[model samples]
Target: MLLKRLIVCLDVRSKRVTKGIKFKGNVDVGDPVEMAERYCNDGADEIVFYDITASAEKRPIDIEMVAAAARRVFVPFTVGGGLRNVVDMRHALLAGADKVSLNSLAVEQPDILHAGALAFGRQCIVLGMDARRVGKSLHFPSGYEVVTHGGRCPTGLDAVEWGRRAEALGAGEICLNAIDTDGMRTGYELEITRKIADAVGIPVIASGGAGTVEHIADAFSTATADAALIASMVHSGEYTCSGIKKELAEKYHLPVRLTSN
Candidate 1:
């Protein structure tokens, strides 16, 4: 198996790193640059910054914040939200994001994914899928629906099929966030996660609901996720990137990357 990654997520709202439960009731957490630097220094394999309200508000991502984070964070950094076109994506990459995540824009205009990949190569194109479990239905046979605009709008697209479409459309990766379990501190939605992971040939980063070392372990072992996205656990000071790595390595015997370099 490939070495599983431990990625730290920072949701930026009004320049501050904020987090919420199931995409609601968000509260300010900290500065994006400082928190990102801190986590990077703590040995995070990658750092993802989401301009949470950009798409909902119909604006652009904070490019300045992306540049600031790039100055401090050394690892691979991905930025998402409010990227509308190839020009916006170009600005973000120029601003120092290693990858640009496409959620709302990609859902509404999937050709942007092809355009982005054509311009920057597939490695820089990441499809961010905000999936919520609505149970098995005729439309969502996988029982998971993709939500957009910060989870306020349901796209009526099945999460599994979306993953497959994204992969075919030149997306190098998929960050699958299960809205039902986001910030719940329980665990990843293994069912949907596994389904998407199985459907996609690209890397699937299982996001949301990371609470414990065991939860992260379950994501890799059971859900078959290539990477795990963590927020509440590390942001709350309950777990550090180093400690999580140690636990996953020693106890669960998972192949977590042990070095920052």
Candidate 2:
């Protein structure tokens, strides 16, 4: 198996890193740059900085914050939120993001996916799928549907099929976040994650609902995800990046890099 990564997520809104449950009632966490630096210092494999309200407000992601966070972290970084075109993708890359994630913009204009891949190569373009369960099986077109505008509006698109399409469109990886499980601390929506991972050929990073180290283990072992994106657990002091890595390494015998290079 490929080395599984443990990523710390920073959801930025109005220049602050904030987190919320089920995409609502967000609470301010801290400064994006400061929090990112702390995570980088704590041995985060990679960092994800998302301008959480850019799409909802129909504005571009805060370039200053992106640049600031990029400057503090040496590890690979992914930036998303309000990427509307190739220009935005280029801008984010220029600002220091190793990869750019597309959510609403991809749904609004899927050609952007191909355009981004063509312009920057597939390795630099990531498709961020904000999905929710709609039915019995958690199957795309039947169980999972796309939610946009910071996961507030339903797009009525089948998420699993979209994962397949994202891979075909040259997306390097898929970041699948289960809306229902987001920040609930109940555990991941394994069935939903597995379906998307099985449907797509590229790496999938399972997001949302991870409350424990065991939850992270379950995500990789059962859902077959290449990585897991964690937020509240890390942000709320429930665990540190090093703490989680230590626990995972000891418990699952998985390789976890806990030292800063």
Candidate 3:
């Protein structure tokens, strides 16, 4: 069986890792490169870095920081935020990113998903979809609206529809984040997570609102996600990747990758 993945997400701003609730009021947590190295050794199946302010600032992600992480950590890591085109994605991959994620830019120019996947292969391209619970509308029957610019802009696109489109465009994975539950530590937004997961064949990584190990277990079971993206829980030092995997394996009897630990 393919073991379920536990991913640690580091939202970066000004070269430092930051945490925020609903993508607002962010505070510096640590150095991005340093934190990534710690998580790599501490048993994160994969690590994801988001240049949290890059899209809002209209600048590309910090390639220097990505290179620094590449040198320090020996694990598969993904880099996202403000990637404008294929050239930008190439730069990140050359700098040692196992994968490059696209969010706002992908929604704005979906062809980039096709282009990135064509140039780097589908496995190298990930779509990080940040969505909000806007209730159901005629346009968004799924009750989840796709939001961009770190949840500042509502695109009027249904989350599940976008997931299906991204998959058809050659995206290898979808990192579905629920803006409403982000940093709340309540639990993952399973409804949207499952909807997107079911709507697409590509692997779905359930993100946002992971407070307890039980929440993580719920993601793999009820949500049927291939991976769980953790932030506040591990970012606050309240949990470790190894510890979470242990709990998921032993207590929940979930198929987690404990071998790496």
> What is the TM-score of each predicted model, taking all chains together?
0.97, 0.95, 0.97
Q: Rank the candidates by lDDT, best first.
A: 3, 1, 2
Best prediction by TM-score: 3
lDDT of 1 by residue, 167-208 (tens): 999999999998889999999999998998898789999998
Candidate 1 clash pair list: none
lDDT by residue for model 3 (20-103), tens: 998889988999888888887888889999997787788888999999999998889999986899999999999999999998
Two-way TM-score contest, 1 vs 3, winner: 3
| Model 2 C-alpha lDDT per residue in residues 171-221, reported as the tens digit of each score | 999999888999998898898899988888889999999999999999988
lDDT of each: 0.92, 0.88, 0.92
Model 1 misplacement above 4 A: none
Using lDDT as the measure, name the better of candidate 2 and candidate 3: 3
Candidate 3's error at 103, in angstroms?
0.5
